[model samples]
Target: MSAAAAATARDALRAATDAIHARLHGLPALQALAEGRIGRAGYVALLRRLLGFHAAVEAALADAPSLGPSLIPWGIDIAQRRRAGLIEADLATLGAALGASAGPVPLAPLPALGTVPRALGCLYVTEGSTLGGRQLARALDGLLPPGEAGRRFLLGHGARHGAMWRACCAALEHCGAEPARRAEMLAAAEATFLAFEAWFAGAP
Candidate 1:
């Protein structure tokens, strides 16, 4: 396909996934997190959930040859985006604040990804969340204690956030997922979104 056609295909995929994406964005639990209403532990719980889910996703990508390509950018390795480590540090801080141990974090429920399309779908939701995370991190900056400990996960990819998200989009564009793959991707994205919303809903 030509450039225009590729852009059209990407747009179509976005349109297919848009409704579920909007719903996830509008979830009450996510709103509370972004609105900075949740305390430090509540924020840590959110990161723990993300860490679990991402651990699953990244592990799959690392083991699956096809899926790994879907995440590898032009030059970076998958570890660069596997941001659970950042979350763990923040969890340690939050745990200390609560006078509790930080090492044993509860993992979020895993989303199924037996196929590359499904994996990409999950990646779409996860990477897209980072875009919104930049904003959420700022909101949290004021609410959390004066340090990077709490918002490190939100500030993931660091100064390269915009570039990393662009890379994610480029990866999607290159997938050249036909209509069927797009549908599978959309389903995966929807399920992933639902899982995250539910996780946050049940958080303390």
Candidate 2:
């Protein structure tokens, strides 16, 4: 990639990251609830917002061509995994907080991949199943310019994922969750992003 294009990509990544952090800060009460530092209603509100914000992020990222292909799948995977892991973890934490264990609590499942809006598919190749890592990597390689811009974009995404994962961890930890469990969930989030990062790096 030319230096100018690389710079633009880097700037775009930074802008996205900033947007996400700003949203996180907007919900101080939710942050408190996730930490297990608030009331029942507050916790529920936080969870609701988290789910919505995650989807919104996906929708927004889907619009940026440089990020669209790589991020769409990453977003889908993270949303699904986070929905499942948080529900399991929340039930355990809430039960502990209330002094009782309970049956599995239900969560809103991720929107079926097909149900994802047509707008999101603008840059994606529609297919029956999820794209494998290798396929995604190849696609991104073709999209990303070779040079500093491509490298910076990959690094910026890695950094953004790290930041988002930390926010999730902070919320879970506040909820009286076990450290090990929190690590496991965060690891899954990291793995999803890292797969993309590796793909971008290995691209010709």
Candidate 3:
């Protein structure tokens, strides 16, 4: 088999979603966050928006009964990896500091994660987000209060980030080993990325 043919599921996903990932990077809000140009208000807005997305995504994962079982064999636990509450706490902290309400945020419409492969695809995009978040968290050092208070979501798994990501990759590889399953994973990942792009672009 050629090198490409022998590539792992994670490699295939990275290749398939490269363009979408680039587009996500180009988003104004995300660009501003990465460049450390988005002020506190902008950061707060971004966090609120992120909370909505994470909440919706986690809800989907929770609602899918079979998803948990599918992931168990791969040593993945959706519960341990959830960050929606972190976002909420961050928002609350920032909001309280600003003497404003961290009120309800809007949720994005998600495609159905009816199958394990499809759900894993969504997890691929969400989980991979943490790798880039470390840098994004750094960009917030001077912007936010120099601690994990209002940036917990961005900080992610902290020292465990690397290990957590490796585990996620293993799960993706195991689940996507089959060509048919890999295709579903790719499609769902593409859809999830697009959902993020649209959510970030729309009014928060």
RMSD of each: 4.4, 20.0, 2.8
Residue-by-residue lDDT tens digits, candidate 1, 53-152 = 6766667667667655654543335667788777777777776432355555565665677676677667777787777887888778656776576788
Q: Can you rank all candidates by lDDT, best first?
A: 3, 1, 2
Clashing pairs in 1: none
Judging by TM-score against the true structure, name the best candidate. Answer: 3
Q: Candidate 2 local accuracy as lDDT? A: 0.32
Q: CA lDDT, every prediction?
A: 0.67, 0.32, 0.83
lDDT (10s digit) by residue, model 3, range 28-67: 8899989988888888778878878988998888888888
Candidate 2's C-alpha runs over 4 A off are: 1-10, 16-20, 31-37, 51-82, 96-204
TM-score of each: 0.76, 0.29, 0.90
TM match of model 2 to true structure: 0.29
Which tens-of-lDDT digit does each residue in 1-204 have in candidate 2? 431232332232223233333443334553453343555555444434333333333444444455434434434333322222332344344342223363322222232222223222211211101122123223334433443232221122332444554443333333214334333333333332333233323322
- Model 2 lowest lDDT segment of ten: 122-131
